[model samples]
Target: MQETQDPVITSVKPKSRFPKSVPYIIGNEAAERFSFYGMRSVLTLFLVNQFFNPTDNPALTDQANAHANKLHHLFVMVAYALPFVGGMIADWFTGKYKLILYVSIIYCIGHVMLATFDGGLSGFELGLLVVAIGAGGIKSCVSANVGDQFDATNQDLLSKVYGWFYFSINAGSMISTVAIPWTYEHFGPKWAFGIPGILMALATIIFFSGRKKYVKVPPQGVNRNNLVFITWYALTHGSQRKKGEAFLDVAKQNFDPERVEGVKAVYRVMMVFFFALAFWAVWDQCLSEWTLYAEKMDRVVNVGFAKFTIYPGQLSTFNTIFLLMFIPLFNYVIYPWFDKRGIKTTPLRRLGTGLVLTALSFVIIGVIHTSLDHGGSPSIWWQVLAFLVLSAAEVLVSITGLEYAYTHSPKSMKSTMTGIWFLVVSFGNLITAVVNGLIEGGGWWATALKGANYEWFFVGFILVFVVIFFIVSPRMKERNYITDPVIDGEVAANTNSL
Candidate 1:
C-alpha cells in the first residue's frame, strides 16, 4: 500500500506565515490580561483604603500596609499555584480549549463578586479566592494552547509568536494599569472592578469565536506517561536498576522509553525554574511594597507641556509601558546586534542577565527607600527609573521563560511543564509572604528588614540567587521538542522524543 499522508501536514509549507488562528488567540489574550491586570492594579489600594479602616496613627497605618502586603502576596501565591491542577486537567481530561472556556466563566463570576461586595472584607476575600482559582485554572491552558496551533512545519515561528503573545499581555496591562486606578479614584471600587469583569466576558467570547480555526488536540487521558506514577514506579523499582544506570532511566524497564524520557526532561526544566523563584519574589514587590513606597514619594510631574500627579497604583503602568518598548527592542535591535558580533543571546543567558538586572533594580529602590527613611521626599522619577530596570528584567526573564518552558517540554507534557513554570512564581510569592509574616511578628529578621534595610536585604537575596543560576545553568542540556502535524486523528511524530 502507498504511504498515507496527513492533509494538514502537507498543506503547510516550510516557513509559512503565522497560523490562521493566531489573531483570535492574541485578541483573547489581550482582553483577558486587561481584565486580570485591571483588577490587580487596584487591589492593594482597595485593601488598605476600603477593606480596612483609616487610622491617624503612623504605627497603625504601617500595620495596615504590612497586613495588606501579606494578603496580596498570599493571593498571588494561590493564583500561580493552581496552574498545576489546571495543567493536569488539560493533559488528562478536557484538553486546553474546553478547560479555558469553562474556567473563564468562573473568572467572570469572580469579578462580579468583587464588584458587588466591595464594602465587606470577608466578601472581598471570598471574591479574591474565587478569582484566583478561575485565573489559575486557565493560566497554563491558554499559553500551551498557543503552542498547540503550530507543528513541525512552522515551528520556527514559535519564538516570534510567543513574543507577540507576551507583547499583547503587556499592552493590555499597560492600558488597564492606567485606566483602572483612575476609575477606582473617580467612580469607586464597584465601577473599577466591574470594568474588568466586562473585559473578561469579552475575552471569553473572543476565544469561543475562534474554535473552528484552532488545532484542537484531544486529551491524552490517564496513561502510563503520567509523571507522578512514573516517578513513584522509579523510586519503588530502583533495586531493579542495572549497574551504571541513571536513576530515572530505571523506569524504562516498565514504562515506555519516551514517557520516561519526558519525565526526565521535566526534571531538568524544573531545575532552571528553581532559580527563577528569587526573580519573582523581587518582581511582584512592584505591586505591593513598591506601590506603598510610591505613596510616600512626591508623585507630581511637571512636564514642559503638562502637569499631573501619578497615583500610587498608576506607577505600575511604567513597568507595562516599558515592557511594550523592551520586547520589540530586545527581539529586533538588541538580540540581532549581539548576534552580529558573534555573541549568542541564548535563553539561559537572557535569564541569568535578567536575574542580575532584578538585583540592580532593587538596589535603586533601596537608595530611594533610604532617602525616604530620612524624611526626605524623593521624586517619583526615581521609582520610574527602578521600574525601567525591572521591566527590562521582566522581558528577559518572563517572556523568555514562556518560550523556554514550551520548547523544552516534551510533546506529551507541554501544559504540565508550563504549570511547573508558574509554580516557580507561586513559590517566590510564598517567600515574600513568609518574610512579611516575620516582619509582622516583630523578630530580629524584622528589625534587619526595617525601613530602607528591606530593599537592601532583597537586593542581597536576589544577587545570591543570580550567582547560583550562572553557576548551574550552563550545565543543563537543551532539548527542543516540536509536535509533528496530526496524522489521522492522532498527533504524529515528535522530533527529539527523548
Candidate 2:
C-alpha cells in the first residue's frame, strides 16, 4: 500500500477566538435552511389542494389527506437517504467544499422547476426528485464541514458552536415557516416556490464568498483500506480469525491496524443511529401530521389588543420559536446548572431524555385528537403546548446528534458517518410513510388504531424505542476525534483522545 499524503491544512491556532470562517458557514446554513423549509412548509397543502384531490367530496378529502401525508414523508425519506451516496462521493471524489458548491446549483434548478412548471404532477414530481438528490447530496457535507474547521487546539468550543449552528437553522426555519405559508396562500404556488428558489441562490452565493477562508480537507481517494473492503474481507475470510476475537478484528491480520480500528469506530457510531431512527419517525411529523391536526382545531387567538387566526402551516413556527428560546436556555442555563452540581450531560443521556419528551409530546397530541373526535372544539393552544415539548426534544436529540456524529468518527470517514446518521432519518421517515400507507389501506392494525387511537399507537411505538435506546446506550463506548494541525508541510501526530 502507498503512503497517504496529507492535504494542505489551514486552521486556527491554540486558544484562538472563534474561527473566522464560522460566520460564513452559519450565514449560508441560515439561508439554505430557509429555502428548504420554506418549500417544505407548503408542500403537503400544495399537493392536496392542487395535485392530489381538488374536489370538495368528503371521501376524496380523506384520501387526499392520507396521500399527502405519505407523499410528504416519502419525499423526506428520499431527501435524507441520498446523503449516504453524497457522503461517499464527497469522501472519495470531491472534497466537502466542492461537493456543496456544485450540488447547490442543482438544488436551485430544482426549485426553478417547481416554480415554473405548472403542467401537472409529472413535472412537479420530477422537480421533487431533483430537489431530493441535490439536497441530500449536500446534507452530510455541510454538517461535516462545520467540524472540519476545528482541531484539538480549539475543540472545547465545538459544542457551543454546534448550539449556535442549530440556532441559525431554527432562525431560518422560524421565518420561512411563517412567511412561506402566507406567500402560498396569498400569492400562489409560483411565487411561493419561486421565492425559496431565490433564497437558494442567495445561499449559494453566501457560501461561495467564503471560498478562500475555509479549511479545505481534501477527499480521500479510493483506497484498499476503505471500510467496505475491510468489512467484506473480514466477513469472507473468517477462517483466519482467532477464537474469542471480535468480528472486525479478523481483518487486522491483513490490514493496517489503525484503519481496521476506524472501521470499528464507524460501526459503533452506526449503532447509536439505529435507535435514533424512531425518534426522527415521530419528529418529522410536526410538518405533516401535526399540521393536518391543526387544520381541524379552532385557530383563533385573543390577545386583548388584537385577534388573529393561525394557519395550519404557521403553527409549525411554534417549534422554531421554541427552538430559538430553548437552545440558548439549555446551553447557558440548563447545561451549566448541571455542570455546577457535578452532573454530566452526556450525549446519550440527552438523547434518551429527548425520546421520553418526544413521547410525552405525542401524548398531548393524542389527547387533543381525542377531543376533536368527540366533537369537542379545542383551542389551537393545545397544539402549541405539544410543539413546546417536541422542540425541547429536538434541541437535545438533533443538535447533540450532530455534535456526536462529528466527534465520534475518524477523520477519513467523518462525512460518511454523518451521512449514515442521516440515513437513519431516512429510514425513520420511511417507517412513517409505510405506516400511513398501511393505515389508509385498512388492515387489522389500522382498524384497531383508528381515530385518536392512531396518535396513541405512535406514542407507544416511540416509547418502545426509547426503552431500547436506554438499555443499549450505557454499553456503548465513546471516542472523540479531532484533526491534527499541520506543521511546516508535515502532519503532526494523531490527536484522538477519549
lDDT of 2 by residue, 1-498 (tens): 999999989875556567778988999999999988999888888888787677755556545666778888998999999988887788789999999999999999999999987458888888988888888889878877998999877789988888788788888888999999889888899988999899999999999999998999999897778678999999999988899988988898888867787787788778777777878998888898877778779999999999998888898898878887898899999998998997778778788888899999999999998998788879999999999999999998888887778777777666567777788899999998988787667668566867788789889999899877767776676666664433442223232211
**Model 1 misplaced regions, further than 4 Å:** 1-24, 147-164, 209-216, 339-343, 406-409, 473-498
| CA-RMSD of model 1 | 6.6
Worst 10 residues of 2 by lDDT: 489-498
lDDT string for model 1 (375-478, tens) is 99999999999999999999899888877787776777776677787888999999988888777677686677788888888988998898777776766766
Q: Candidate 2, which segments miss by more than 4 Å at Cα?
A: 1-24, 146-167, 209-217, 336-344, 406-413, 443-446, 473-498
Model 2: how far is 364 from its true place, Å?
1.1
Clashing pairs in 2: none
Q: What is the lDDT of candidate 1?
A: 0.85
Pick by lDDT: which candidate is best?
A: 1
